[model samples]
Target: MKKQSTTAALPGKKTVTAIYIFVLAYTVVQLFWWGILLHQQSKEIAYYEQLELTHRVHLLREPSEFMREMQRHHHEQRMRTLKYIGEGTIFLIIILAGASIVYRAVWKQMRLQQQQQNFMMAVTHELKSPIAIAKLNLETLRKHKLDEEKEKKLLDATIRETNRLDQLCNNILLASQFEHQNSQPFFEPLDLSQALGNALQELRDRIQSHDILADIEPGIGMEADKFMITLMLNNLVENAVKYAPKGTKIEVSLKTEQNDLLMRVCDEGNGIPQEERSKIFMKFYRIGNENTRKSKGSGLGLYLTRKIVEQHGGTIAVRDNLPKGTCFEIKWQDYSLQPV
Candidate 1:
């Protein structure tokens, strides 16, 4: 499917934003202008009252009373001027603060919408490529008589493509379930060592190009949901595969420290930027422009991984994997076996 272009709307959005800013500026200017006019009018009224008082005092020949009335009139004018200035200042502050908040919210929403559009485009391409390859492979097998080796290769390729499609579908479904709070992990007694080893072995089998290494502690048992744990591990490894160069070392380590279970997935790839590390887990968020990015992904892996970890009472963090790479570290606190 051809991806829809959003470039055409860029200028329109910018124009709208410019207009909004212009209106806000104009309003602030008008508010200050009105305040100035009110201040001038107040002074004029005070001057006229003072002149009237003088005229009345002259007619009644009351010099001391005139002086006292003049003082009172001046004080009242000053108080009125201060009151107008104070009220105008308060209103101005409120208007600016409200405008700032609205602008940030609108900007954030627009960014999220753009990311979602990118995700849709990526998913379309991702879904099509695998399905097309698998169909073509099957058709080739049916239409021609091939040697045993050739047949095995085609079947293997078809299986890989089919698995990729299945995983994409699973990620989408699981993400939806977690988003709506409709899914809960069914906790049970799990052997952490065995599960981690199996997941790593499966990943190694699926991705033959990468050198996957594991350092799992033996007999580390924990109470957890096995399926969710496997899914989480797969996501972390898949993410490493997507970024890391072919044949580079991808290390998976699991160990226990002071009643806590720690799992780290380190990749020998270009590390994530410091500023973007925090945003990687947000749904539908990708590091670069989706249209131009060469990597194939639906941007749900990290998000789903984080959700699964959180669901199982664990914390996940990312850091620079020494020299040149990224490492995803996960910790489950106070790990212990529970009755099944």
Candidate 2:
């Protein structure tokens, strides 16, 4: 089966409208320039001819000398009109170029607006559901007499839902922090292996459908914000679990290559199309519409993860996992690492 790429289609209406405007403006400018020149030429010709007629009828001057003078005047006027045409064409081209630039800016702004709308819808749903579930669990506990085990289960469920809400809120806050360019991250030396372990454990509890395989190398420490690094790792693993098929394997590995530390999380899933690989990290950009999406996310995870990694002077990328899935790879050079 052939996989379809998820490249976003251009805004057809906007594109066509831009093109139409360009063509219309160009045409109008050309037509007006030529029309004005032609009208002036016709009036000049009529005046010259009428002046010659008056002179001939009154016998006021030599006809040959008058004819030569009129020819000179017409020649000079033609040259000036030609020069004006050239200048007008150049000016029109500049105006059209400016119009093109404005159109591009407007198009980009419209797309961003659409993404923001989607983000709002997704975030609202994400927040509302967890809060509602926690409230329902609390109400159930208060309204009924239940066994100790059942009561404990309900309370645990409530706690879990509330925790989910907390995580979502944290992600939003972290994303906002990253958006502000001046926000500084506190970094310190930490054990990368331990952080991966903790992130994987948390993800395992959150998503039980996928099995995670960890192949982490010990003694690989780096200077980073441990909390943010853990959050990044958790987001990656959680993303894999969400998209990958049930019971499929999700793999996490950390290793050293020359002067770089490479960390990868891979999964057996319907992989992202090549075209969409770059866009998945954009804020408020999910692969599909929020209302129709089966997967649960606010679309800020990968964006925040990328920002966190970049703050540490690391790079993150996505590639196809061998056989049948996607792989997210992160690499940090030795320069990016610091000892405790």
lDDT score, candidate 2: 0.81
What lDDT does candidate 1 reach at residue 67? 81
User: What would the TM-scores of all predictions be?
Assistant: 0.94, 0.81
Per-prediction count of colliding residue pairs? 0, 0
Can you give the lDDT of residue 99 in candidate 1?
Answer: 96
Global local distance difference test of model 1: 0.89
Candidate 2 runs further than 4 Å off: 1-78, 335-340
- What shift in Å separates residue 96 of candidate 2 from its native position after superposition? 1.5
Instruction: Highest TM-score: give the candidate number.
Output: 1
User: How well is each residue in 26-85 modelled by candidate 2, as lDDT tens digits?
Assistant: 876776777688768766876786676566755646678767766776776677667767
Candidate 1 regions exceeding 4 Å error are 1-4, 59-61, 337-340
